[model samples]
Target: MPTLTRRIRRTAATAVAVAVAAGSALTLTGTAPAHAHTGPRAATSSTVTSAQLTAGLYQSAYSERNRVLWATSAVGRPPVTRSSLLKVDPGTLQVQAAYTPPVTDAATGAVEAVYGIAVDDEHNTVWTTNTRNDTVAVYSQRDGRHLATLPGVAHAREIVVDERRNLAWASSFGDGTVVAFDTRTYKEKKRVTVAGTQPAGLALNERTGTVYAADLGGDRIVEVSPYAKEPRLIPTGDGPISVALSADGRTAYTADQAAGALSVVDLRKGAVTRTVPTGAGALSVAADRRSGNVLVANRAAGHVTVVDPRKGAVVETLATGANPNHVTIVRGTAFVMDKSAVGPERQDQAHRIRVGR
Candidate 1:
């Protein structure tokens, strides 16, 4: 196994390489902001509000059952010492409760910091990806209590829950595999491998029990069906980091970080039908069910671009904070987590945008 330091360095190098390949000059340490394309093309009627959260905020999920939001945070590089799971009030964006992760090494004070989060409302639990420690953990959504930690998830990037099937699927970016676990037992149930692809973000189709993974390294989407013997691959644009499914499940949208575009894939045809230019460092995407508008988080541009699938154009641009890492839409509201620039004084923030229909 590679040392923690080596793993972190490798991941950073890969990210830089991907950015360059996608024709972007952005680097891990570079703080230069990428300009967003705005004008009459952008929407002028969207309401956006923000709140300062803790540092190192990476991703967030909304729990319809609990009526709250869950987020994960981890500060510093390898040997990360500061990390917490936060429960926030969706309306006010206030931190209702915070739970610290258990220390892994007593002498060194190392912790299993989490980076990605997903909520399983059916079971009233939350799942988090401990990317630094290569593991996944479950927690109680009611009180922010630790439930269980399952190890051996190499570089876990994202997780999604299938409440109907009682399963949770996680993507292993380092090993190009998606592993499934029984939600009730928290045991590894199946592992589906997508050779030569680094799976980053995951989206599940509840109606079909099919999981779609964004292939960051291969520029494609890996489709894993419950009944299929082999997974299917649908080609996408350069450096597709995150993905979202349309309301009808007929189209899949990808945030191509390297290309600074959103690739719309026709699920039935298994091909990219359109590539719409979004902005630089498009890290995450979410589809609003009410208006059917797709929201893309542009990390380098420090804004969120709202696109109308029917028109194939950007309708509005909402300026988020620096480094918008992830966006999740819940009940017609979009929650964006921004990991404000790299520094001790720079606190992360969460933005709530009401994407009007």
Candidate 2:
């Protein structure tokens, strides 16, 4: 775990509050439908073929909506132009929109080093954790227009929104702190410190109003209750890089990148109930809410493991691009961020999976 230190010093005095535009759903705009399709739908009932299953895993729910897959190219030398939001159609697995972050001179002006990206589905906004600028950039998901650069966010890394409370929480790797901001106004409301060297990922169960954070260096998951007075630390596998929760909010899965395993934590017990062998370098984990399957993106192995959380076992493995890193599960699609070092820019490919019981 990296020490929480002041790595980025803010020099600008300007305060900016950008509001991402909430554009109309682009369901009928392109060749693909307008709405985004998620998870398994009623039309996919037959015994699916191998190709169909793979396509189903990646298919969009809203045939009316599209999934935007974004990749950060900072891992490349000379900082390759890799930060791009790739809008993919689940039906055809086709690229609909390729949005690239505008390049800026960090030496003179505000620039973003995006570590994580989250979709504000309700607002139709895309929020990004800008580590370099120490802010969250809100953009309109439909048209790729900048809404506002949220000021006052410190070392924003992994961010999650609690819809029930209408709040966003960002974990600060530099401060070992998690700060809560009002989603409607982007105002910091509270900050809590975690007993870890560095925190990696965060998940909020809107149903329970419970916040779970994977502390990478502490080898634990810090459970914070917005309704309670204090937070609790639950021991987990080594170096949990990412986390995801079941739709019902009873199960939480952690991807232990160092241990090369996936840790399934029972939310009720607040303890790890099972550890299943995934491929080496498990970087990200996502839950197929409809199927009760946990998907892991193993960076070093260039593959993904589909696990049955009930049995604590790996049920299937699918090959992916080189160095697959981040993952997000929306509806029926699992958008993979494959960061491959290729020349001045890193190549990121989005792969879909059909998740079925």
| TM-score of every model versus the real structure | 0.88, 0.75
Give the Å shift of residue 278 in candidate 1. 0.8
Give the poorly placed runs of model 2, Cα more than 4 Å off.
1-82, 100-110, 151-154, 341-346
Q: For residues 1-357, could you state the per-residue lDDT of candidate 1 as single tens digits? A: 125424444543321111112221211221222234344455346777777778889999987555678899999987889999988777667677789988888888988899999988767799999998899999998888889999878999999998778889999999999999998999999999877999999998977889999999999999999989999999998999999999888899999999988999998899988888988999999998778889999999888898887778887788777889999997568889998854455668888777756
Off by over 4 Å in 1: 1-44, 341-345
User: Each candidate: what lDDT?
Assistant: 0.83, 0.62
- lDDT of the structure predicted as candidate 1: 0.83
Tell me the deviation in Å of residue 14 in model 2.
45
Best by lDDT: 1
For residues 92-197, write the lDDT of model 2, one tens digit per residue. Answer: 4444554556565655432354557766655566677776666776667688776767766566777786655767787777767777877678777888886545
